[model samples]
Every structure is written in structure tokens, then in C-alpha cells.
Target: MSNPVLEIKNLHVWYRTYGGYSRVLDGVNLHVYKGEKVGLVGEAGCGKTTTMRSVLRILPEGQAHIPEGQILYHGNDILKMKPRELQQVRTRGISMIFQEPAAALNPVFTVGTQMFDVIKYSGLSKEESRKDNIKRLAIQAIKEVYIPDPERILNCYPNQLSGGMKQRICIAMAIVTARELLIADEPGTSLDVTIQDQVHRLLRGLVEKKEMSLIMITHSLGVARELTDRIYVMYAGNIVEVARTSDLFANPLHPYTLGLLSSVPKLTGGGVAEGIYGRIPDYLRPPGGCRFHPRCPRAVQRCREEKPLLRDLGDGHQVACFQV
Candidate 1:
């Protein structure tokens, strides 16, 4: 396999509060090869978004601290990059589609204004930065997302557009600037079911067409199965399992992963879906050893005293639990 477009190694993040620091991400390790779509699946507050935000170095500086980690973008460490280098990365190397479309766009600016600004600053050459050229590129990008009447849509404000339309516009902006990796933090959120499907399909098509690596953070296991090549199952700030999407679904290893898969409602109408027994552990005072030990049915004394590192189980499947 070729080198990964993005790699995160031994990442640990914390948030400072009156009650000391909260451990948000603990020893997270992940990678995305070129053109491969990877899924990060976990319940809310599992540090999925924190991991992505750390990749972009977008975490709030005063509140968030990274005591250990390396975020490598094509072999370069993003955490140590200078401002100019970081700016270049933000403009051309990677882009993120935030969860809320309405919050991402500025209500004060017209869609064209925002789109043109993004295109202009997206590492464009002096000759390509002209107003006319930027407008043309913006229109072309909007067209790619299957939005109709690009010109008219561009002229409208974000408030005037529907939720789906705003999301497509956000997608257009992301693709226009993102040359290597696109981090989508729940792009289909807050939309109708039908529109959500359309957005997911559009994202998959765009990633394939552009040959860009993707990290799709979604709560829906069904969406993860449908869209990603590989899946990483997270639990309370740690990655409990990693495997090919098909393998993870067919034979989940970690106890947490099993719970997640079992909780999903079956379309074929099996009785009530089984829910995970316990809620996520509190970050300020998380369980000592394996974070999921408190909720795991098969947990032993070892699981309660010593944290388990991810162990390879052949064929690139890995789980961080002793019983597995």
C-alpha cells in the first residue's frame, strides 16, 4: 500500500476546566490512504469530533491541550507547522465540512461572496485569482454538487436557502479548496431522511471523482457501512476496534463495538434493538483501565487494572480488549 495521506499517532487531548483537565482523546491512532474513505463511529462525546478537529489544529487553544501526539499530513507534522505552512494546509491540503450547515455559513454574506472568497484564497495563482475566474470556478463547483441554477443560488443569502441547499453549497465550498483530504463531521445532519441520503451519495461520488482521502464521522453504523472502506470504532476517548468496513460489521471484536452493532435497529423487523447497558464514563474521572470495562459483560480483573493495547487479529483487524 502507498503512504497514507493523513496519519494520527498516539494522540491525547484535554480540556481545562475548574475541575482540572478532562481527558478528551487518549492515544488515538488512525490513518487514511489516498482516495480511501474511513469512518469514525461512536456515540456522542466519544471524542470523534475532537480527533478530527485536532487534525486541522482547530481546537480552541486556551481550553484544549495536546500533551502528546503527532498529526502527520503527507509525512509533515501539522502540530509543528508554522503559520504560513498551516495556512497553506488549510487552504489547499485539507478542508472540513462542519456538522451544521446553517452555522457554517455567514448569514451576512451572499453565497457567491463566500464561495468566491474561498476560491480566491485556495492557493490560487495570481492569474487565476481574478474576479471573473473565481466566479467561474464557484459556479462550476456548485454545478458538481447537482444544485440547479447555480448563478441564482450564488446570488442568494444563506437564510434564503433550504437546509439541503445550504448543505450542498457547503459541500461545494469544501471540494473547491480541499485538494487532498476532506474531513466531514456529520455532513448529513439536520436534514430530512431523503435529503440525507442524497448528501451521502453526493459526498461519496465527489470523493471518488476527486481522488481525495476522507474521514467521515457519523453516528449511523448503516451510513458507515455504506460509505467507508475501513471503520474505526471509538469508545470513551479510545479506539476499541479497527477493521475493514465489511469485517467490522460481520465480526466485531471489542465489547463496545459489539454493543454498538447490536443497538442498531434492523430493517427486517427483529424484536426491539438491544441498547448498550451503560452511558459513557465521565471524562474528569474516567474508569482507570479499559474505558469500556465498567460496561463490558466479559470484563475480568485484568481488564479493570490494566489497559489493553490494540492487538492485531490477522487481516488488518485489531481490537483493544483481552477477551477478544
Candidate 2:
């Protein structure tokens, strides 16, 4: 196989709080092949957002620290890249579509102004960067997500548009740069079911059309299963399972993965799926050994005393569970 478009190895990130440092991402291992869609799925506060932020190098100033692991892009270490190199990566290589479009856009400026700034910031020439190109690109992006009348929409302020419309605009801006990798942090979170499906399809279309790899973070298992070729199940910042979508769903080894799959609402007469009992452990002082042991139905004594390393079980499927 060709080299992966992006790779992350044992990424450990922490946030310094008034009380203590909270381990937000602990040894997260993930990768995205060129033109592949990889899903990062987990409950809220499970470090899904933090992992995306780490890749973008947009962690709040002086708040989060990378204590361990390496993030590689085209075989280069992202953690070691200089400021200029990282900027190039952020602009020419990778772009992000944040979850909240309202928060992502500038309330003070028109959409056109903001988009022009983004395009110029990515190193476009002022002379070559015509207003028509900016407007056309923006409209095309908005139209790709099935938004109505992209021309009029581009002229409006972010606050003037609906939440779903704003999200499409965010996606448009991210992909309009023609970056090789797109990090979508809950791109469909706020939209209704019909609109969500439209946006989801639009995202997949964008990745396929541009041959760009996508790292989509979401809590929706259905979304992950439908869009991503590979799925990573994260719990309290730890990646417990990594497998192809079909293989993981057909034969999930880790108890956490099983619990997550079981919770997905099914269409058959099985009624509403049951949720995993217990809450996510506080990151300030998470559980020792296996973090999921407390909630794992099949957890044994080994799970409480020793943390399991991710062991490949052939065919590229991996799991971190002593019982498995």
C-alpha cells in the first residue's frame, strides 16, 4: 500500500487546570490513508475534539501540552515542524471545518471578506485572487452542500444565516483551499436528519472528488459506519479499537467497542438500544490500568491491574483489551 497521508502514534496530550493537569488524550494512535475517510467516534469529552485540535496545532495558547507520541504527515514529524513549516501544513496541506460555524466565522465581517482573508492567508496572489474567483469558489462550495442560492448566501453575514447554512459555509471554506486533508469536527451535529444526510453525503463527495483524506470526528455511530472506511473507538482519550467498518461491526473484540455498537439504535424490532452504564472518568485523575474496566461488562481482575497494549489480530484489526 502507498504511505499513509497522515499518521499519529501514541499521542498524549494534557490540559493544565487550576487544580491539576488533566490528561485529555492518552496514547491515541490513528492514521488516515490518502483519499480515505477515517472516523473518530466517542462520547462527548472523550478527547475527540482535543485530538483534532492537536492535529491543527490550534490548542488554546499554553493550555495543552503534547507529552508523548508523534504526529506524522507525509513522513514528516508534525510535532517537530517549525512555525513556518506548520503554517504551510495548516494552509497548503490541511484545513479544518469546525463544529460551530458561528464560532468559526467572524461576526463583524461579511462572509466574502472572511473568505478572502483565508484565501490570501494561504498564500494566494492579490492580483490572481480575483473577487470573482473568491465569490465563485464560495458559491460553489455552498452549492455543493445543497445550500440554496449560494450567491446571495455569500453576501450575507454569518449571523444572518441559519446554523446549518453556516456549517456548509465552513465546510466550503475548508475544502475550497484544496487541502489534502480535511479535519471535520462534528460537521453534522446541529443539522436536522434530512440536512445531516445531505451534508454527510457532501463531505464524502468532496473527499472523493479531490482525492483528499478526511478525519471526521463525531458521536454518531451511524455516521461513522456509513461514511468512514475505518473506525476508531475512543474512550477517555484512549483508542480501544481500530478496524475496518465491516469487520468491527461484524466481530467487535473489545468490550468497549461492543458496548458502543450495542448502543446504536437499530431499525429491527430490538427497540431502543441500551447505553453503557457509568460516566466517563475525570481526566484529572483517571482510573488506573484499564480505564474502561469500571464499565466493562466482561472486565476481569487483569483489566484492573494491567493496561492492555493495542495488539493486532491480523487483517489490520487491533484491540486493547486483556479479555479479548
Candidates in order have lDDT scores of 0.93, 0.87
Q: What TM-score number comes out for model 1?
A: 0.99
Q: Which residue runs of candidate 1 sit more than 4 Å off their true CA positions? A: none
TM-score of each: 0.99, 0.95
Off by over 4 Å in 2: 125-127
- Error at 136, model 2, angstroms: 3.6
Q: Write the per-residue lDDT of candidate 2 for residues 1-324, one digit (tens) a residue.
A: 899989999999999999799988889999898888899989999999999888878889798889998999999998899999999898889998888788999998888778777776776667757877766766676777777877777678999988877888888788776789999999888778988887888889888998999998999888999999999989999999999989988898888778887887788767776789898999998888899989989888988888898999999899998887
| Among all candidates shown, the one with the greatest TM-score | 1
Model 2 TM-score relative to the real fold = 0.95
